[model samples]
Target: MRFERVWWGALSLLAASPAWAADGYSVLGDWPVKATSESGIEAGLKGNLSYDVARFGGADGGAFADDDAWRRQELSAFVRKPGMFELALGYDFRNEVWLDNFVRISGAAGDLRIGQFKTPVGYEESAVSTTATTFMERALPVTAFYAGRRLGADWTYEKIPNWYLNAAVQAGGDLLGDNRGRTLGARAVFNPVKDENQVLHLGLSASNEKRDDDSLRLQVRPEAFLAARRLVDTGALNRVEGIARYGVEAIWQRGPLLLQSEYLRIGVDRDGVADYSADGYYLAASWVLTGEKRGYKSAAFGNLKPRRDWGAVELAARYSHIDLDDAGVALGGRQRDWTFGANWYLGQHFRLQFNYVWAEARRRGTGLDPQIAQLRAQIYF
Candidate 1:
């Protein structure tokens, strides 16, 4: 990406801003480079590193099976014209997935984004930043229905207070060069109440998709990305033609406690078979024990910032279920999960997390259960 060339003269520019200068920065420390040109242009780097280790147990035979990995290693650099627009290039080294490589324009017409970025299909998927997800991973429905990252364009409108609208079109393939499908999505959000100590967000979304091939696979890793296989899998729907996705999400925060939920459904049109359908939903609540609240903006919850030098501590729990059985599609099965988690935000940019999950999956009357515990050390800037 010739990133070095982009920052070749960063030292001189950054040195001009004595107020913005920091002692050190990087994945391991502070944000090293942040500078503004004399003409009001801003340039800087962004990165997020998440390292995970897990232990699997229970009667599922997954016991004694353990794995560790660099869950995500992503870095990006951006140059922006304050209040006007910005250009950013990013990539995830661990998954070899492209992050935000796009051109964003801001003005009276609202935000018009082009290039590779996330599609505004679901509330959690579109609004919540990956670095700030409530848990190690999102709920089942979100993971299965949301279009990750695609080569396309997205438009967002928020000219009216407390109301947001977004629509996007995607073609070709995903960032990883997979899911070669054409997609279109739209979402609308309304914040009935927003104040210093309370906020309520309501949202609805819908999407249509068509893949290059007639075969489609829908699977989800059991709330633990480190797992090698998906316990509930719909191998490959051989006669699929088109797909439709829909979702409803809501979030309410009062003081240090937050409540959130989402329901997502997907429908498939098969050639010789009846239309198939699946749905999933989750309910979660979190409380910040250190008297800190997560910030809210752009229709999403921002990462929590520590108020104390020792940082912030949070406790959360969630229950989720996904049903992939419908229209004679029996083998896809269904899964129900319960997860308890704790997060310790050491600073604005570093965090430690732990999660315990109990997953129950069934297909054609047979069941599989597993207990998993995982930990993550993450840093972001």
Candidate 2:
């Protein structure tokens, strides 16, 4: 929620359009050791560290217990001298103690970041929850669009070579007005199932937000009050004043079992008076009972690697759900949740996480609505 100075000079004057390279980078799940050459200095440093704790309750008197911590403390020293140029700085802290403080400049084709980032939506809220997602909480429609650093500019393109594409646009600050108006996004990833160990994956995404007064829109769940008064008589609150989203994701690991899933949808129209919509999805499975062989990026799904072994241990489970409504436009109130989770890895980098959550609510007269049970422990570095 920070990023000013003419929004960082309008993302440093837009127009650079093309740069993509994420398929590797980890800390709690290992990886991150690349620096054999490029002129040492440990090849310009690297980073990762995390800590988590969670507890939950609700029966009528919602329960409590929460303690969270995370730190990224800077890295990425130098690279220039005509060799793919680079420079980066950091300092991340979170616990409500969410501090960003960043700087970046990359190359090889493109890169020019400028602090407070992370908000591309879908695919487990853009992954990186201490490492390679396996659930420790993140589903509820991707944590209801939780946000990350604020100021932004991210672009990438790969004009066919293995296929890749990305885009990010932003404007920070604003929950009501003053200048909280833009947010557009895009992402596309393809591998089409290459070989070696296994490969087959696909991804797609979209986003649109002009928020300041739509309050993230989409309300009207009082068990559907005449579709929210006929969407407030047709105009749908000036065509859902603002907020739009889209998503899709899939995976298929070739060995040791690892599958994945994702789907999202959101919309709200207030300018037309009131209209709403909502969506959600999830499905997961993991297994590496000591037979190892889960590479291709450590198996989250397809890229290849279905066999191997070591002290190796992998086990995971997941189920998720969500829904929203306001067809009659009485304005917001209808919720759902049914989650289950588990994960453990002792080899990749470090891993241990847990989850047991359940939630449900309905509001029309506020009765028989309230239930929650949560528990979580996650550590990454």
- Write one digit per residue (lDDT tens) for candidate 1, span 1-381: 222322332333334434333433322224547799899999999889988878888898453368778899999999999568999999999988888899999899999889998877667777787789879988877887776778899888888999999999988877678878898989999999999999999999998888888777788878888777677778778778899989898899998999999999988888988778889999999999998998998888989887764568899999999988874664688998899999977657777788899998887788878888888877788
State candidate 1's TM-score. Answer: 0.90
- Off by more than 4 A, model 2: 1-32, 36-102, 105-117, 120-131, 135-140, 143-181, 184-208, 211-238, 244-269, 277-309, 312-319, 329-346, 349-381
- Give the root-mean-square deviation of each candidate in angstroms: 7.0, 20.8
TM-score per model over all chains = 0.90, 0.30
> By TM-score, who's the top model here?
1
Model 2 lDDT on a 0 to 1 scale: 0.49
**Deviation from native of the Cα of residue 316 in model 1, angstroms:** 0.3
What C-alpha lDDT do the candidate models reach, one value each?
0.82, 0.49
Q: Lowest lDDT 10-mer window, candidate 1?
A: 1-10
Clashes of each: 1, 40
lDDT (tens digit, per residue) of candidate 2 on 126-189: 6343355555555556555434444567665554655667777877642222335577777787
